[model samples]
Target chain A: MKIKADTTVCIGAGMCALTLPEVFDQSEDEGTVVLLRETAPEGQEEAVRRAVTLCPSGAISAS
Target chain B: MSDLTLPMTRQRPFDPPDEAAELRQRASMHRLTYADGHVGWLVTGYAEARAVLAHPGFSNLAEKMHPPIPSRLDLVEERSRRGVPRGFFLRTDPPEHTRYRKLLTGQFTVRRMKALEPRIHEITNSCLDDMEAAGGPADLVEAFALPIPSLVICELLGVPYEDRGQFQEDSKLLVNLETKADDVIAALGRVTAYLHGLIQRKRKEPADDLLSGLIEGGELDDEELTGVGFLLLVAGHETTANMLGLGTYALLTNPDQLAAMRDDPSVVDNGVEELLRYLSIIHLGPFRVATEDVEIAGNLIKEGEMVGVHVPVANRDPSRFPDGDRLDLARPTGGHLAFGHGIHQCLGQQLARAEMRIAYPALLRRLPGLRLAVTPEEVPMRSDMTIYGVHRLPVTW
Candidate 1:
């Protein structure tokens, strides 16, 4: 699975990083998503999918 | 009960007013009479309130026409106009609101707020220190609840911390329901001038703050910049401060919850969410005018009719939250409208949550014996103002 975060649209509501810290991190300065791994870790796909849904700005996607 | 008014003032500070509770039980929405004698619809159901907030048919532009307070109509009109001295995007609809929000979204992302958490802890500790030095019976509103968020917002926005007293006075006038039109206008003028000068300074010397970031970004001109700054300054502190004050009151009065928070470290995150849902500090939720006819929960709300969501009542709706009226710290309280919903939900919600998450535990640990300095009945609640909270939370440790 591949994960992408659109920095322009992310409002930094923080749900992504909070839900799946292993798969995603946030920029300290910009507060937008900083993708930790392009592909989801073997067992973490469900968590990553939840983060995408929880993002208020629709800034994250996984496929 | 066709002539129900919005926000029937609470006799008990912690719960929704009796009239509001009655309306919520009767139906989700009711035809309402405004202080101006204009008729509208009041939504008191959780699902209905979310639908109204998220639906394009309901326009936030209604703030100009049907402001909750009778006396603020002129001020609201001036503030809601197209170009000059515009109200915050809280009063604007889609494309316009979207544009303004996009400019600042990057500034408030969750990771950015998390980076600021250490500073939030420092600020909370400093306030507790001040309270400790002042001795017993300190007004929490004056000492701890108000200042922590105030200082943080001032630093975040690049507003000089020394000038907080002046802005605090001006902001009070702006939100106080009984404030005279002349006073409100004068305060508005002063705040506008201060922000204009500050924005110019930022243009010349961009600093490491949100205001400086907006100035360097080049998407906004002076007036829009002032609107954004003024909105953030007022909103950034006020709502969260109330949550701190009123949430403290709620917990102290309900000892079991307070003990639960004190004993268990894990409950702090969920506790803040519960407090937000229970207090619903922004009690008079945003008002919107139906731009077109739409049916909500079997009710036909006609075009141009104003609609409002009573957040406290909707949050406590039994159908949505099991045993909804009771404050349960352990409950999974997601989907609450405390920060509102839809595009205009809240820009600083993550920041607010971070502050609450840090501040609450720090206070509990620092001042373990903290309790009310006066009886609950004696504490003055800010029912008449736009935000609902205690005016002074006198506490002793």
Candidate 2:
């Protein structure tokens, strides 16, 4: 399992695409995080590492 | 040695200021005084208010912070005069608050607040059908928590719902802590001259909302689109109409969490994240200014000192909410800073959690014997403002 977000430490605060929308999504023109899956899918890796610890701007990262 | 001043007021209208939970149980930073008496630092735990709101060496400019009232230094001298765009980047910090929070974070997304959840369930059933045709003992903070986020932030900032009674009397004299600081800088310069005449009528008629899609995209100018439409019309309807009037007075004074959220309407999205973590209503939480020297949670923050944080004692920090003063609508209420934490967090926090999950289960399943017309010690509480909440709730079925 490996994932990433860091759209330059995303401040969109979308809370990692509103809590793991199948491995994050956003950016309808700069709302930030849009990493839609770098790995986690089968059994959604603990809901993409709990949406990377509910990203209050740590800008997600799973490994 | 007794001057802790900054918003440790409540004295229990739903808790949180037992001198900020006894100064976050005596550690997570302390020394306080401001209101211009100039003594700083306050934090109050939840990991020192998320390490001074995710420190970029803590600084949100206004002369490196500290006026948590002293009429917020007349709203920082009425947003420092010429052109007024600083009134809210939650008071600017990063790279000029990273270009007006990247153009208001694509106008608040979580798929645009879940496609504004069916127009927030048809504006919460037409404000519970105007509180059931104004019959039973109403005043639910003026017919349903100030017109359901003031008609969904005046239809998401196109404004003109008959100019919402002069922008709700210029956002109630710019948030009423007994007004006067030159009448809150003349009611925030009459909401910045009514958002600079609605951004010059959305640049000569460009409607279809969010200030005509920020004037059909030219990357903001007219004083940064009237300072992002006066900070989304006063932080999008005064913090979700004071979190739907103090989360319906803490669920009509917690009658079994309002009959377990009106008999499990799937606990209305963990009962709106446990009523935004047990009504942590925006209480005096954003101020910082260490911009050169810092060291959090184990003290020593110097360079031009001042910090405030406090958000209802860091969202009731019982070491980050394990039974943090109980309001458990099925607990694990995710990391509550109640729409604040890092990078000036709370760009309409998912449209204020989709207007409190569609206005608290449609005002508890359309007033199924709603209850509370007074007597939770006669309601009142906006603890002389700066946003605590419950200026008038008064309900009934």
Candidate 3:
């Protein structure tokens, strides 16, 4: 799986941070998406996918 | 009708003094039980706490609270009949609760929370900026916690922000457990009256807020609207408000955790989760009455018993949450009891989580050099109330 983030559309609800802390982070100043990694690192895909499913805004997806 | 088939009534006293942690300990630890003339069987053990929360036998519909809430309603025998909808979302069991919940379920989805993210950050930063301008001594509760969510819920519910002060006071007094229970009831009535005013305005000229949306959509009747509105205003504002204040206090004192989060903002997510689990404010949370005689964890709870669901206790339950007793951000907390479980679980949870996830990191990053203005021991804390929050969290950069 590959991890891709669309920070432009991310509203920063921060569930990605909650679920997939390794691959995604939030800019605290304005709660914007801050990607930790663009690719699914090792076994982090499942977590990234969970983040995508849990993203309320449909702002993220895992390929 | 009180026959051999149904056991007699029981009452359990769960409130404790000074230390809330110890109170939960006592509730879960001892065979502590109390019996009153009217109120049914009360369950106090950790196992029983979960049982009470999830038990279908427990009825939220029992009209008259045998003991009565306070003096004015003393002879009232029963609490009160459902003047509003028979079962509004929070006051209903599975199917009804589930049905009513569906109305607002999509509202808290991650996408919805994301849309509100900018608003939350704006609320927090602007409040902090005001605090900064006000100089050293300001109550974090008043300046930050109270406003951010108050403003957010107002924006969401379509409350005119300028009129928030009066309604905010209503919300505050309504939640004060020390206030005479009757006065709280009166305050609730005032709030409903206020909501009626808002409903009228929404009826006249529809706006983009939740109230207007609900009204124009005709999704709920006036009574349902009042109940939902009241719940949202009080639950939406005070609960998160308390968390923000208490959470700030928690993080500020836990230097290791503070430094860890500051070092890597990524920790904010887990840090907020742990903070939420560790310092849940609604200690008198999720009250329920047993509908029928039921057995839980080897104990038989007689029909009509009342029980208070303690989230903090459940969160600290070792059986469910490993190393549950301690506040460890590193602990694998897949599910925490912070927002609760079942149909009645907090509706505003996603929004709450979004605010905290934003507030904690921003506060830390904004004042990376921030330090407690007073010792943790000296710092003001509120343990006496149902809502756990510091009176004032004094800090400086």
Best lDDT among the predictions, by candidate number? 1
Docking class of 3: incorrect
- Candidate 3 chain B weakest ten by summed lDDT: B3-12
Candidate 2 chain A least-lDDT 10 residues: A48-57
Winner by DockQ: 1
TM-score of chain A of 2: 0.30
Question: In model 1, what lDDT does residue B120 have?
Answer: 96
Per residue, candidate 2 scores C-alpha lDDT tens digits across A1-63 of: 989777777888798777778778888887998886699988888878877766777878888
Of the two candidates 2 and 3, the one with more favorable TM-score, higher being better, is 3
lDDT of candidate model 3 versus the reference: 0.65
Candidate 2 reaches a DockQ of: 0.23
Candidate 1 matches the true fold with a TM-score of 0.90
Clashing pairs in 1: A12-B109, A12-B110
Tens digits of per-residue lDDT, candidate 3, B119-231, equal 88888899878977877665677777778888898899888889887777877675554566566667777888898888887899998877887787676788788777877
After superposition, candidate 2 runs with Cα above 4 Å error: A1-63, B1-23, B27-42, B45-58, B61-89, B92-129, B133-143, B146-149, B152-200, B203-223, B238-240, B254-280, B291-300, B304-308, B314-369, B372-396
What's the DockQ for every one of the candidates? 0.36, 0.23, 0.05
> Model 3 segments beyond 4 Å from truth?
A1-63, B1-48, B62-78, B81-88, B374-380
Q: Write the per-residue lDDT of candidate 2 for residues B35-149, one digit (tens) a residue.
A: 7677877787887788778778877766555566676766555544432455366667667778778877877889988888898788789888977987788878788787878
Candidates ranked by DockQ: 1, 2, 3
